[model samples]
Structures are given as C-alpha cells and as structure tokens.
Target: MMPFSTSFASRYSSAAMLVFALLSAVAPLAFSAQPADNPQSPVLPKSAADWRHAAIIDIDEAYQLSLENHPGVYDTANPDFLKNLQAAKAAGLALAVRVEDAAGYVAATQAFNVRIHDGHAGMSHNLDAQQLPAERWPGFITVWRGDALYVYAAETGGPSVGAEVLACDAKPIKQIISTNVFGFQGRSDEAGHWWVRAPRVFLDRGNPFLVLPKRCQFSLNGKRSQDSLVWKALSQQASKWRTESYNGEQLEVGMSEPRKKLFWLAMPTFAPDEKQREAYRLMLKGLSEHRQKFLEADAVVLDLRQNQGGSSEWSQSFAQALWGKSRVDRRVAAYGAKTEVWWRASPGNTDFVTGLVEVLTQQKQIEGAQWAKIQSEGMQAALARGDKFFVEVEPALPGAADAKLDVKLDVKADVFGDPPAFKVPVYVIVPGQCASACLDAIDVFSLFSNTSLIGAPSSADSTYMDVRTQLLTSGLAEVIIPNKVYVNRPRKNGQVYLPAIYIKDLEWSNANLLKTVEADLIRRKQ
Candidate 1:
C-alpha cells in the first residue's frame, strides 16, 4: 500500500469511495454529454481556447471549495493565508488566459496549489489515464550536502558524482532551483521544505512552465568546468533511484541490536495496510517481550529517516508499549486540554466522517472507528443547528471521572502489565521529509523525559488536515481539500521541529548513519 500524508485517516472512508465510484460511473456520460454551455457536462477541449476556458472553470471551482471548506481560510488570525489564496487564484486565472495547450493549463492550475504553501492541498492527475507527455530529466541528480548541492548520481558522460554544482545557465544553482523547481511545485518558507525539494531541481517533470537550463558549472577535483545540458527521457530505473534517494532506504519495522548494549528500531513507514498493520503488531509484541532489555540499554535509536507518514496511532502504540499507556495517556491529555479540533460541517466532510466510521470498524480499528463516529454525529448535529464547524474538545486525564481514552489499541493489561518507567535515552532520527503521521510520531516521542531528536528538522504541516478530493470539471485533475482545523495546537502551522543534536554533513546511508550516531553517543559520554 502507498504511504499518504497526515490527512490519510479518512482517505478511504465510504464517502471517498462513493465519490470515486460515482466519478467512474459518470465518466462516460461526462465525456459524451451535451454542448459546452451545459455546466454539468465535461468540456472536451479541442482547441487552445477551450482548454483555457475549461482550466479557468476548474481553478474557480477549487478556489471556491477552499474558501468554503478549508479551515485555514477561516483562520482570522492568519489573514495572510486568505490573501495568498486570493493572489494564487488571480495568478492562475491570468496564466490560464495566456496558455495555449494542456501542459500550459496544467502549470497554470499548479500555481494556485503551490502558492497555498500546503503539501496536502494540490492538484494531481493520473498520467497513464491522461496519456500526457512523459517527464524529461538531465542525466544527473543532485542532493543537498552541508550548504552546497552535489551530484548524487550521474549517467555516463554526465557530471561526476562528487562534483559540486555552482551555477546553471550562469544563474546561481540555488536561484535556479527556487524558481524552476519549488516555484512550480509547492513553495514553502521552511528550511525543511527546501531540504525536501532540493533533489528535484534538475528534473523537468513535464511542466512547460519551466525553462530548462542550457549549461551548468560544476566544481570537481578543485577545478571549475562547464558542460552543455543534454535532456533525456527519464528511465524507470533512474526514476526509482531518485525516489529511493530522496525518501531514504525502506527499512523493515523491527528492533535490532546494532551494538553490544545499543538497540535500533527501524520504522521507515506507518502506512496503514493489512501487511504493514500486521508488521507493526508483531513489532510491538516483540518490544513487549523484550521490554526489560530496552529499558536497561544504553541507548535506542528510533529510526524514522525515510518515513513520510501514514496512521499516527502506530507510533502512539509504540510509545505506549515502551513508555507505559498510563504515562503516555496522561501526557496526551495534558496537551489535549489546551487544544481543540474544528471539523468543517460541510456536507462532503460530514459524509466523509460517516463513511470513515464504517471503514475503521471493518478494519478492526476500534479507537479510530469510535472517534470517527463521534465526529460524524457531531458534524451532523452542527449542520442541523446551522453551525459552520463541529468542535471536539480534548478528553480529560485518565483518572478523571469523565476521562475518556481517545485511542485504545489491543494491548492486554495483564499480558504486559504497567511497563517500568523507561530510563534509556531514545535518539529519534528525523530526516527533512518526515511529515504528517511522521510528525505525529515525533510529538509522541517528545513526550518522554529521555527522548532527544537527532539528524535534521522535520517538514511541518498546517493545522488543516483530513483531506478529501473533488474532481475538476475537466476530469483531468482533482483538487485535495482539508476538512478539519486545529485550534490552539501546540505547534503553529509551518513550524518545523529542530533536532536537539544536529549532525553536520551527515551521509544518509544506513551503515554510515548507525556509525555516525554511535560515534556521537560515545563522544557525548566522554
């Protein structure tokens, strides 16, 4: 199963499935429907003007959805988000008027999604279904190391692997990346954003809006040289390598003895699928069996370098196994007291929650099923009462008379008893791409007294979450819209979590990572 952003909990809800089913059923009708004048009928663009007009309609629809449903638009304290939204819409419309082809129109719509500064809010289409032109890339890929960009991989006759890229087309390499890559993709002001998107600088992913560089200046063997660019079709093998490099090695989910007294728990992803779910269950069971060994270990490295996100509850379960459920619950309750979640009461969102309840129940995720049920009921009531949002307050502490556990997994009380107070120092390895439920994992680990973050700052998300998609009228793309907004959350939107111990110029390979972390631990004890 594919990993998703933090907004994945309700992704496969009945409402979403129903929408997809309807879209599929009506796709034929939409294609062969009446004249372009009919708003309900999909416009098959046969000319440049037709494509531009269709794109404008789609952009307007997306903008309206955001205004009506996105919680960020309603945040009075952050008026800039609204202002940016308006600007992006205007820019997209203006660009649409000038575009003469499908590629141009796609880039125009992408501008709106990019300016939102949100990873969850974007326009995406299935390339195979759309039969779009394939993406092209220069015969090399670059990665960020220290403060400079270096070639990580190269085809024969391309830049050397260790070469530092200085400039492209006489423009500074950083400037080129900021404009061509991040500008068309979503742009964020956070350092983690740059770190995550840096690798895409040299790849032209079918966006006609970008101007590919003609020549690049590279410094190798202490000598500077320039080479003319040669764009080639991106091969499947090359594409796979690029993705793996950016996301890090996909390690198995289990604990290991990396050293005599040091342990390593490699949890590369928390993707919520039957196989991954079973893997997490078995890992937790193993942790339970070896609880004493971990508690007495010198250090434990919770490796999350490649984790993008999935279900956050997986990480919470891990924390509960080692830190004790009562302790973790109390910490969560204290944090929850100061926070609230406001789910939009729109018909689509309410419907999504209703469907989510059924899906979670079938999956045997009792805690999530119960939470979805509460939200579904609350939203329906809010809609009936003419309220715009349904509010959910944090539950009281565990021992309180009205205390309710938000999430209770299948850990038998008698089998594991109350785990002793964990005293081992946990070093969490977070890469720049760590986000969504991955960020949730960081939050869980931080609650413990003996935890310290290492590596780089993690990518951040806004208070907006739990996304649902609406297909554009053109049927070529879909717009992702978030349903819930956090009120008084501990971390502000776009705020990254900085690691306590930063590893400078650290290589991301598995062996090097373990060696580096071990060396750091030893030096600290000196």
Candidate 2:
C-alpha cells in the first residue's frame, strides 16, 4: 500500500505531464485539439482510437505480469480462475477497441477489474489521468438495509431519510445498482462489495458507458411516489457524508465502558503508519493496565466495523495480549502446521520485495524490514536455483510424528510465558467492510472458545497475499498483483465469516450500536 504522503498528487502529476509530453511528441495530431465550427461548441481532440490501442498493449503487459508473477494465476482452488481472467482481458480489449474517449476507457478497465472478482487485483489511474469532466449524481445516496435500499443521505428537497428506493430510471433499483455500480466496482464477497460500493449507485463516477438516472421511485410513509431526479454536482461535504455513512463513524484505538459491565473496544484501523503503530503499542499497554477491568466485565466488544486492513501482526499481538502468548502461539502453531505458502520467484516480485525492505527500514519498522529481507533473499535464491516458487511449510508440533512436512524448518526451542487469559465473554463486531488484516483479526479471535462474531459477514480474500503495485507501460494506470499464495489455509478463498448473531436491523452509529449490543447481551442473559 502507498504511504500517506502530502506530495503524492504533485509527484504523480509531474510524471503524468512528462508522459503526456512524450505522447504529444510521438503523435502530435492525436494530442492537438481541433477548434469547433461554433464558438459555443466544445473543442474536441482527435479520436482516442490510437491511444486506446496503445492502452490495449499496456493491458496485455499487465496480463503477462499477472500470469508470471501473481499467485492468483496459478490458483488451483478455482479451476476456472485463469479462464475468467482471460475472458476479462478479452472483454477489456473488445471494450477498448470500441471506446471513443477517456470515460469509456475508464469504464472498460474498471469493468475488467470488477469481473476478476479479486479484491487485490485492480487498477489505479494517475492524478491527471482522472481529470475528466466530473460525474454527476442525483441529489441523494442509498444504502443496503435488510432486503431493500434506503435513502441514507440527500440534498434539500431530495428523498427523506429512511425512504425505501424502489426503482430508478424506470428499472428496479436493485437491477440498476447491480448493472451500474456493481458492474464497475464489485469485488470478492457480495455483501462486502455492496457495503463498500452501493452508496455510489446513483452517481456516475466518470463512466459514460452507462446512462444516468433522471427519475427515481420511492416508498415512504406507506405512500409510493415517483420523483424527478434533480441531477447536480456532488459537493465535497456530501461526498464526505456519504463515505462516513457507509464506513460508519471513524474510530481510534481505545476502550470505552458503554454499560456497567460491558466494555467496547474501538479498533477502527490497523493501518501500518508509524503513528498507528505507536497507538497500537499504547493500546496494548492500556489493555494490560486495565486487564482486571476487562476480565470482570460481562462482555467485551471488539469493534472492527471500520477497519479495512493493514498488518496482520496487530491482530495477532492483540490476541496474544488478551488470550495469553502461550495459548495464542499454540493455536497459531497448530494453524501453521496445516498450512503451506508459496512465493512466486519472478524477477519483478523479487525486486518488489527488495524495494519493500528499504521502505520498511526507512519507516523504522525493523521487524517488517527483516521479514522483507528474508523474502527477498529467498526469492533470489529460488530464482538462482531455477525454481518457480519458494515454498514454506510449517513444522509439526512436538509429538506429531505422522505429519509430513514439505519444507525443512529451522525449529527454535519454545519459551512459553503463559499469562492468564481473559475469561469474560468476548464479541467481535464485524461489518462487511472488514477485510484483509481485519479478517486476520477474526481468525485469531475465533480461536478463543469464549468469543463470538456478530453483525454482518466480513469480506473475503483469495489465497493471494502480499501485493505490490506496478505502473503499466502506458503510464495511464498502475496494477496491483499479489506475489504469494497460501495453500491449505484454514479459511478457504472467497469465504466469509458469517456472524454468529446477525443484527440485520442494527444501525451503525456508535451510540445506537452500543445500545443494541447492550440490549442483545441483556436478552442473552435473560
């Protein structure tokens, strides 16, 4: 993942400008704008057919990179995975051939990404490449609730909050969303994809391939009505509100006593920035200091609704702190014993890992840097040995003589420090947005006998892991590809963890969420 840098836009913009200048020099006519016959008419450049053909070549390069370096290409779990990818590539090329402008190109690429159905495989355009005319939105946004879409936010005179959206553009609302929104921005899990992208169903985010709705039907107060959609430019505040509504309120790493015997721990993010790392350390320290408080509580809610992903180590460390290092380690060891991992030893993947070592070292993440260094060296060694993959299999437990290991292990003597475990009932609040490291947290927490998962089902990821970004040959966009594949992982690829207690009617606001959980705990006790 890219670090949070203030100058990222400027740096990318500069690079885009350079690329644009080069393209102009190579094809001056393609770059030059032709004046319109009428002054009021919009001046248009030459058809982007030539540019589109060039982008097709770039896509071909991306396809080759995925085939050579991405673990997903070699996924045996999904027999049709490679076929689907090939089909998506063919579809994208066909779209590129027919597209007349940048908007169509964007749609074609996004459609390709969505069709792949992998969260880790996607394209990100550079800054200037995204400077096309702004996409308009109807004066409201909708969210999935129960089996229906509801108006979550709106401009003045738009649909009222809680109004059920029945249809848009004379088509059933669900059909419209599935066609326009999901068709362009969907990922692995259905619930998760909806949770993350449904809010944009009414907006056209620079995809001119689909028609924008001009009218919508709503059902409110037992009265059905069709309203003319007033299309308008989305204000910055509205965009912010839409994001917050979908993601729920932002949270920091902290614990709160929502009730006399209920503790709510907000772990909104596990992002691996230096600040977040320090915050996690402090949170762990706080947990240790208030260990008794958590132990005595009737329930402890570990809220991960807003967490997307980061380093999995954060979740593992949290588990170690709460469940005791020895217990956590034993479970982790057992899990690892059954799993195997293979890193693609392609030159590009090896170089990416080598670069990560330097980046992690500069960020003061010594542990991460060391891990990257090891991976880099292993990949280099594998390449030298003419091996396609660097394989690793976990060692068996002390007495498991029947266990067959695929790789040699450097076993170290275990020094067990068995801290007392928290005996209170624990609940992990997972929303659909929980993914990657967030899912890792669920993996660790689920190992405990006293813990239960609640709320919506979490998003899923394939065996592919450890992604690296590579710029396409066209310089118009970059592709993300995963370098390693996990074999025999406990959780199957594209599998979601369904909450033990699913609260379909629960509102995501902090206050309401706490109240609902508290009420649920009360009912459980009764």
Candidate 3:
C-alpha cells in the first residue's frame, strides 16, 4: 500500500482515461467495451445516465420508489404486468448497460442460468441456469446433475481439468450448503471462478505438499484433478459460502493468523450479539498492533460467505478498520429523476420529505460498505441530522391507495471515507445466507479493484425489506406485502446474480469440499 502512479496515463484518451480510472482499482481485465454478447451492435441506451441511475439507487431507494409507483404489486401480479415489465427490461438491456461500471463481478455476471419454479421439492422439476444452451461456456464439462454437484457434460470436454473437486474439501457439499440452500434463496452467474481459491477448508481435503496450487493429483482415470478448492476466495467470484453447526447455532473462530504480511481471518458471521463492540475493537487492535504480522503476507482473505450480516454499524466499523479504501467517496452518485417520483407514491400520505430535508432532493443517498455507516465515519453532524430528519406519515386513504404516487429525495452525507487500500487482496466469501446489510457490503466490495465474490448467492434479494406489510393471499392467507423491493428492472433478467465464475459442487467429483480447497491452496503456497 504505497503511493501509486499510472504507467500509461499519456496513451489513453479522456474517455478511456475515465474508464481506466474507474477500473484501474479493479483487475486488468479489459472491459467488454461492448456489452458481453452484443459486440459491434449499436444497441446504445437512449440516455447515458440510465446505468449510473441504476447503480446508485439501493434497495431502500428502489423499494421506496416501487411503493410509490406500483402500490401493492409484489412478486405476485397479473400476467400482463409481468409481461410488459419483461418487455421493457429487454429494451433497457438492448439500449445500454442498465448497470454501469458493473464489470469485474465474478459470479454475478454468469452463474445461474436455469430458473426453477417456486417449489424445489426435488431436482427433477428444478432448472439449473448453467444448463441453458446460451450459458454454456463452450469447452467445459460443468453440469449440475440432479445430485446438485456439477459433473462432466458428455459432449463438452471431459472432466480432465488438472484438478477436479472430488469432494467438498473436507465437509460434504450436502453439509456445506444444506442449511441455507432451503427457501427462496437467490444465486448469480457473473461472479465466476471459485476454482482459483486454494484454502483447504472449503475443499475439505489434506493434499500432500507435492500437489499444491493447482492441487493436481493423478486420478484413477490416469488424469489429475485439483486436490482442493478455496470457497472464501471464490465468494468474490459471485457464489456465497459460510460454515455453521448443522443445527444453525453460532460456530467458533477457526484459523486466523499473521503470516508473511497477511492475516487470513475466517469469520463465520456478523451476528451483532455474538461479540460486544469492545470485543470487535480489540480484534482490530490486535490486527493493527500485529501489523508487522499482517504486513508480512502479501494479501488477506476475510471470509464471510455464510455470514448473516448484523449490526450494520458494527460491520461498517470493522470494514473501516480493515481496508478503509475510497469506496465511500467514489460510490456517491445522483439519484435519477424517476427515483423521486417513486418515493412520493407510497401507500400513505406523508412522505420522506422531512427525512430528506438535509440532502438535495431528486438525489441519491450516501451508502457505504455497511449500514448506518454515517455513525461509523464519526460524522456526528450527519448522524445528528439523520436522527432529526424522518418522515411520519398518516394512514393511507382507502380509495386513493390504488393509484401510483411519486416523490423525490436527495442524499447529502458521507457514510464511508473512501475505499481504503487493502494490504492484500481481500476475498469476501458469501453464500445465499449472506444478505441485507451484508449484501450492501457486497455491493460496495464489488466496486473495489481488489475484491472477489465466492460461494452461492445470498437470500437478501428475495424480499426481505426492513419494513414490510403483511397481506392476504390464498396460500399463506396473510403475507408481507410491500416487502418486495422494486428495482424498476423488468422481470425476466432481473434475477440477482450474474457472476464471474461457475462452480460444480464437489459432491459431483466425489471429493471433500474443505480438504479439496485446502489441499489446493497449501500446494500453491508451497
């Protein structure tokens, strides 16, 4: 983490320079420049501001917007409304990237291709997105068999890739994801490549030092396979992961240490009650005091895939103490015009006008990698304002409730200082269980150049608003109504994840998950 200089600043044009500047913090992977699929096709967006508009509007904004414009419309709706929404989304995708600077997403960009029905009683009826013809990255044999593990596709190349995860490192894949895979958890396809992580816990294996890095070992078929796979490193690739007791009680701290300039802290979750505020500070203090230990390693892996995020304030503080990069400053963007309309349209009369009095109207609110980040930044000024500016509205009128309403609000405070430089590339491990404020952290981490998403997608995107209204329905009788967040996104392509890597569960390979990944990483380290 030293001062840096651009080696090729003179060569890039202004636009390219901005692109470079925006992405320089990211890896050197070239941007699609053109959209992933439609290269050379001038499917330009009518407004360049559209993508920027989508990126800044968080779930709070989208939900508030939806309550205003489309009252009471949750995932359940009339077929045509869904149809039109899908159609409009296609147009948006064709017009321009709805998400700008959304490159470098590991698992989010390309993970899940198949969509299953609401019920997943068995694999027979479910669909795996990776099986879709379009999603198959030609030349690989990845298939999520009914068993849940990816096996070799008969047609694509064989499963002869130097390393095949025979098992989930040490633990069974069934055991690793079983607890959280239930329910309407979401997943992505863009955050791909958990294959690179070498941590043995994920692989559940103990490979000899001879089989490191690629963790290649000659298989019974006379070929070799990757001895272990690191799930935490892969979470940044888009899938989320975390470990817990079979019954869901909190697990204890595992391996964390200072080696060669890094401290690989494998945290299980961010449950607020788990550790007192002072305990957290103590851990940070230890890491800081032991900076020499951390600095010795080249990078660090803060694995939190299975981590159910709690205490946004606590999480925010922890992240601040860690990398403390420029994530806060650069992430600020304007709230698009339409966002204002959606806010005022909620079911009730009074709106966020009072709450938003301090910030610019028709503007985007500040968000850091954590929730209530304003408090963490020591911005008592903004915190003082946040406490004062809240909207108290009257009940909705029976007759007027059905129509659309819209309001505009602005955000004017800084919650995070900026994305801080990490002494090492931090690999954020996430699973479908990691969500809400946790997802907020993911969103921010994705913006940094040195992060990766590994593990399965979290459940946050599946309708978990902080404030929800229970409604009447045939099946559940009463349910959470306004809980659904409206992304203004058309239905079809609006699924949560689009990842950078794709992983076939280790059960498919008949290997241990933890041992496999550990063996792989140990081999690499050697």
Off by over 4 Å in 3: 1-255, 258-260, 274-279, 287-296, 310-315, 325-327, 332-420, 457-464, 469-478, 483-526
Q: Whole-model lDDT, candidate 3?
A: 0.31
Task: Give me candidate 1's TM-score against the actual structure.
Answer: 0.84
Sorted by lDDT, highest first, which candidate order results? 1, 2, 3
Which stretch of 10 consecutive residues in model 2 shows the poorest summed lDDT? 3-12
The most accurate candidate by lDDT is 1
What tens digits encode model 2's per-residue C-alpha lDDT throughout 1-526?
Answer: 2211111011112222222112212221221122334322222224687557755765676677677777777667667668767877876777777666667767778777776777667665543423566756787777775467788878788888888989877799878888788777766246766666666787766676777778888998998978898777777867876776675776777777776878777787766457767877887997778777777888888899778775566677788778777676566655556566677888877776676666667767555465556667888999999887887432232232344322233222233455556778888888877777688788888878788887777778666765566666555565767667777877777888888776555247777667667777788789
User: Which pairs of residues collide in model 1?
Assistant: none
Q: Identify the runs in model 2 with alpha carbons over 4 angstroms from their true place.
A: 1-47, 128-130, 354-374, 384-386, 393-417, 503-507
Please, what is the TM-score per model?
Answer: 0.84, 0.82, 0.39
Give the Cα error of residue 37 in candidate 2, in Å: 37
Give per-residue CA lDDT, model 1, range 1-526, as digits (tens).
1133332222223332223223223333322223357634344578888878877877887888777767777676567888888877887887778776777777888887778777766565422425445677788877775466888788889888878999988899889888887777745466666667777887765666778889999998899988898888888867876876674566787778867778888888876457766777888998889888887888989999778776666787788888887777656655544566688887767876687676667767565566567778999999899888888643332222353444354322223455578878888998887887788788878977688888777888767766666666566566776667767777677878988876544247777677767777788789
Candidates in order have lDDT scores of 0.70, 0.67, 0.31
Error of 1 at 462 (Å): 1.5
lDDT of 2 at 403: 40
Tell me the tens digit of each residue's lDDT in model 3 across 253-293.
Answer: 43354344445555555443345444566767776565555
